[model samples]
Target: MWIATLALCLDEDYELIDLMEQMKREAGVRENCFASLGWLLHAKGEYEKARSYVQQLLNEHSLLDEPAIRLCYSILGGVATAFKEYDESLIYCQHVLKLCQKCGEDAPLPVAYQDIGEAYYWKKDYDLALEYEQKALDLLPEEHLQRSYIYRVIARVYRATYHYDLSLSYHQKVLDIQKKHLHENHLDFAAAYNSIAAVYHNMRLYEKALGYLNKALSICKKSLPVNHPDTQRIERNILRTINHYNRKRQYKVSNIILLYYLKSLKSDLPDTEHETCSILVRFLFDGVM
Candidate 1:
């Protein structure tokens, strides 16, 4: 059991697979191994494989303990969320919430709440998202590590609703906690900075937005490989902000049409067209075209 658990601790999940068969003969070992393996597979993006383990755990004959069963359902919900199956994810998360009630184990309730909120967020129901996230926030203590994520999610919902000040407030809350707890080089700084930059972008505070974007970009360049998706995404955001700042004009159909022709002549890429289109938007916004 120690060896099996250690395998998971080291993130050598492949080593756990062979041990699972041998552990199945043991009393408590097999279930823990299964749960850990399921979570590992999910995190690795092996969604189908993770689903199989979770399904087995939830099967009628399994009779796994309440906490174990709840974990499996949560993993199932997470996998669904990863695949953007928010409706299905909500059902699984709801199941976990029910389990938490039945077992008198309220500790997992906050996580279930967060999962529900996240599902609503992805579904574009900003109002519902805020409600559920606020529930999670209320349940979580300010000192709890997970509150950072809840704050970030709430911030995102506010941003989507164009509540710029509220979004910045929540994002600042996250930063306040993160600065005290997380190391300076932690990847979360990138997310925190990006979130702040987005709010600034919405407010048309381009200089502040650009500053935060650069901060995120710098962290990504140091922590992630240049070709990493996260790094690329930050680069894209920086480009977008720069383009927006350069085009100081309101939206005008006339400018957009001109941008389309200019883009067609200059570059065929849809993204290239978009970059040029922002310039046209600026012309319209500034009423200079």
Candidate 2:
């Protein structure tokens, strides 16, 4: 179990996932494997499967201990958040928070606050989102790796509220924390790059946005499955940003200004030649001559 915890923290998930599955086949170990297996599956981005296992854990045990219940709720809440079920996410996370309060457990408090903060973020309540995420951050030690998650949520809140500088600052903190724990090409790095790209995009800095987006896409390609939703999402974002850049560049060439330029050019050409060129310009600009 200690090795399992280490495997999870270190992102050595494939072997840990296999070991957990094997443990589930054994008799007494099966009961103990559920929460760990559920969390590991969630980390692997197998959300439906994670939910299935966690739900099974809840149903099989009439009376799970506090830690098991907290893990179960946390996994379910995270899956709900991934699926955009903010209300359900809030319910599960709030339940965990209440349970912690009743049990006088302080250790899970930061996790509960982070989870609740994320749900509020998706619900577009930026004030509550920042407040809860700040509470989570305050609970964490300065160098704690878990602070990265709280920093990310705060970054997203800032991004949504149009505070680009603050968003970038928090995102930088997230990257700094992740770099210390995760390898250079870790999928978490891809997520952080993608987040920073989003901030640049909102700031209308398309070149910087494109640069970060490309880095994120490269990492995703190296790590995630070909058809993974995250890979496809980054692909779509790249296309959208490219389109926006092209449109912005096109807007810089004012239609009236271009027509005036053409009129001036017409003065220096024969009427027949000018008419031919003007027709081409009109067709190109209006899609009809």
Candidate 3:
């Protein structure tokens, strides 16, 4: 069992499959093995395959145990969320929440809340998203390792509501918590930096935004190939922000401003600088800046 668990974590899907086959041949298939395999397949993004195993486990003749039932609903809810079926996800989450409450299993409460929050977020109900996320955080133990996810969800909700300051705050909280638990170059850290940069960009704090964007770019460059979509997107965002700020009069006067602008024909530049700053002007016109 421990070997199978390690294989799952290591993402050795073939090894996990072989181990499960052997287990099935030897023991006539166990509920725990099916559940574990379901999670493994889910992590690998084979949602349908995972769901099939989970459903088989749920149909077992053995009286449905509390843990098995909770896990089944949780996995089903996750699959629904993955498919962007938020309403269906919420239904399964509600079921899981009730089961957790009945069994006095506080450990699953945070997961249930987080799933519901995500469903609301996908539904564009920012208020409900924040409400459920906060409830999840309140129920979660202080030392919970997944606290970064809660912070990230709250940050996303705040961003959707146009609360840039609050969004930045929660993103920073996620970064701090992730830094303590994850490696410096972890993808999660890069995501947190990106989120923070986005809020700063929305607030017109170009320099601060560029700083975090660059950090995200650096991490992506080190950990991911240059052609990776996320790395390219981060680079593009950094370039766009730099271009926007470069043509601004305030940024032009800053010490960090590029010296090439100083050598350019000042008389030919637009009087208000807005005309020359294509990205910022576009953002303003689009009501995004």
Candidate 4:
């Protein structure tokens, strides 16, 4: 169970799979083992496998009360999110919220709220996302890892709502907390830098955006595998920002100019690599003449 928990938290998929198989063989399908396995699978984005185990655990654990039931809902919410079933995700999160309320202001309340906020964020409801994220932040235990995630969520909501300054503030809060509690090259640190850069990019502060994006790209390149989508995305974003500024010199540019340029680029090249390259080529062509 301890090994499974560690593997799930660290997103070590192969280790979790091996540990789970050994555990199942030794324990003959225990509820706790199934639950842990389910969570591990969920972390790996194997929603079907996760749902199988989670459903089994839910079925076997007839006397499950607030804590255990809340855990099941949380796992289900994650699985639904992975499958892109935003409405289903929201439903499971609502279950968790109810369970939290029933548990009388319990430790799980913040986590439940966080899940709901993430669901709202995924659904593109920035107002609800901010509300739920703030609620989660208010309920979160001081100095907890969950609080870092809540701060990040709030930052995302602020960014989505075009509140770049507010987004940067929340992202910086996450960065400060993570720096104190986590390793320097932690993925969460990369995530924070990336998010801050995104806000800067949206605000048309290309140089500042490039600085943070490059930092994130450096950390991601070192820590993550070469093919990791996040690393690749950040690398492309850095290139895009450089190209964007390069292109601006050729024409009268403003925030509106950049916004329209990005919107047009979004249609042809949904992935970052193609978009960045296309923008760079356009910039070079415009400037060379």
Cα lDDT listed for each candidate:
0.74, 0.79, 0.71, 0.73
> Which residue segments of model 4 deviate by more than 4 Å?
1-33, 45-48, 51-53, 56-69, 104-106, 141-143, 221-229, 232-246, 249-289
Q: How many residue pairs clash (N, CA or C atoms closer than 3 angstroms) in each of the candidate models, in the order given? A: 5, 0, 0, 0
> Candidates 3 and 4: which is better by lDDT?
4
Residue runs of model 3 more than 4 Å from their true location after superposition: 1-33, 61-64, 141-143, 185-187, 197-289
Give lDDT for model 1.
0.74
Distance from true location, Cα of 73 in model 1, Å: 2.9
Our model 1 lands, by Cα RMSD against the true structure, at 10.4
User: How would you order the candidates by TM-score, starting with the best?
Assistant: 2, 4, 1, 3
State how far residue 203 of model 2 sits from its true place (Å).
2.1
Alpha-carbon shift of residue 194 in model 2 (angstroms): 0.8
Ordered from best to worst lDDT, the candidate numbers read: 2, 1, 4, 3
How high is each candidate's TM-score?
Answer: 0.65, 0.80, 0.61, 0.66
Ten consecutive residues with minimal summed lDDT in candidate 3?
A: 255-264
Candidate 2 Cα errors over 4 Å, as ranges? 1-32, 62-64, 103-106, 253-273, 287-289
Q: Which has the better lDDT: candidate 1, or candidate 3?
A: 1
Tally clashing residue pairs in candidate 2: 0
Q: Model 4 reaches what TM-score against the true structure?
A: 0.66
Top candidate by lDDT: 2
Candidate 2 local Cα displacement, residue 219, angstroms: 2.0
lDDT of 2 by residue, 46-139 (tens): 7897898788778867646767788889889989988999999999999989888877744478878988898999999989988999888888
